[model samples]
Target: MAENINSIKQKFIIRNKLGLHARPAAMFVKLANTFQSEVWVEFEDDEVNGKSIMGLMMLAAPSGSIIYVSAKGEDAEKALLALGNLVEGGFEEN
Candidate 1:
């Protein structure tokens, strides 16, 4: 199977009290790196590589902030779903 630019995208809200901090950003990067696709996260006019910890942290998405996760490649769909779940689950940082 050839690797095509099959993109997938999802939007998530930061409802966690702490919002997107280092720990959660780390988790997000870790998860983003798991897929054989290119992943990105966007907030406002900024977009960063989802697999990059520093890049993710630069977003500074606080509580009630809206973010968009997108991926493109062979596993784009899976990557998108996984990221969506992670964000929806608040990165499990209760």
Candidate 2:
């Protein structure tokens, strides 16, 4: 499935006052679930499942914190770009 293989890494800064807390994390998870790719988030040395709300919350991504996002699979490029947009846009400014 090499033709379907795709992946990308990007960093985004949290601009929302609440950071990437429960609501935003839930939104992210929901959006990510709509895709058919493996998505993940990384911060410093920690990495977590992008579709796991609990796992995302554990990151404690505070406002202005830079986070890394990546995706791989059939729709990895779209997924990663969408997620990066979400984070960069601060979850649509909540």
Candidate 3:
């Protein structure tokens, strides 16, 4: 039998100067693809697939903008936490 997974939603702020730019979006996509879950990012009224670089870019979440992340699957919690950490850590930039 397949295990039931729950979905979770959390908010985050962009601390990086570039916001969700190409490089960071790519990174986010790569990270999202690592797990077998559905991940999405929401800004205002727009929602984008977290695993898609183009989708993430469309959000144009500038620095200091509040964003919402939601994930559903076995790794939902872990994925959200990791992604939250990624954003909070400034996309792991120097």
Candidate 4:
């Protein structure tokens, strides 16, 4: 009786000058929280909750670093698209 939900994962590079620092991390978390899906960010060997500001900051990813984003839930695809756009857009810091 339950609907099917799939998880989506995608890779993105940190294009922002400051990378995923406090500000950008905060923005990521804020946008992530808006979705009903569960979000995660992976950098190197570290994976953290995408909705957690502290967790995102702990990745310590710098500009040009590679990160993988995963989302699972009803809105997984949408979440990935928006997050991908944000990162690809350099967090709009420029």
Q: Which ten residues in a row have the lowest lDDT in candidate 3?
A: 85-94
In model 3, what lDDT does residue 83 have? 93
Q: Cα deviation of 47 in candidate 1 (Å)? A: 0.5
Off by over 4 Å in 4: none
Best by TM-score: 4
Q: Which stretches of candidate 2 lie over 4 Å from their true place?
A: 1-4
Please list the C-alpha lDDT of all candidates, in the order they appear: 0.89, 0.89, 0.93, 0.96
Per-candidate TM-score against the hidden true structure: 0.92, 0.91, 0.93, 0.96
Question: What is the per-residue lDDT of model 3 for residues 1-94, given as tens digits with 9 covering 90 to 100?
Answer: 9777889999999999989899999999999999888999999999999999999999999999999999999989999989999998899773
lDDT, candidate 4, equals 0.96
The alpha-carbon deviation from the true structure for residue 48 of candidate 4, after best TM-score superposition, in angstroms, is 0.2
| Residue-by-residue lDDT tens digits, candidate 1, 1-94 | 9644798788899877888889999999898889999999999999999999999888999988999998999889999998888888878875
Which residue pairs of candidate 2 clash? none
Q: List the residue pairs that clash in candidate 1.
A: none
> Which parts of model 1 are misplaced by more than 4 Å?
1-3
Cα lDDT tens digits, model 2, 8-53, are 7888898888998999999899999999998899987899999999
Per-prediction backbone clash count: 0, 0, 0, 0
- Which candidate model has the greater lDDT, 2 or 3? 3
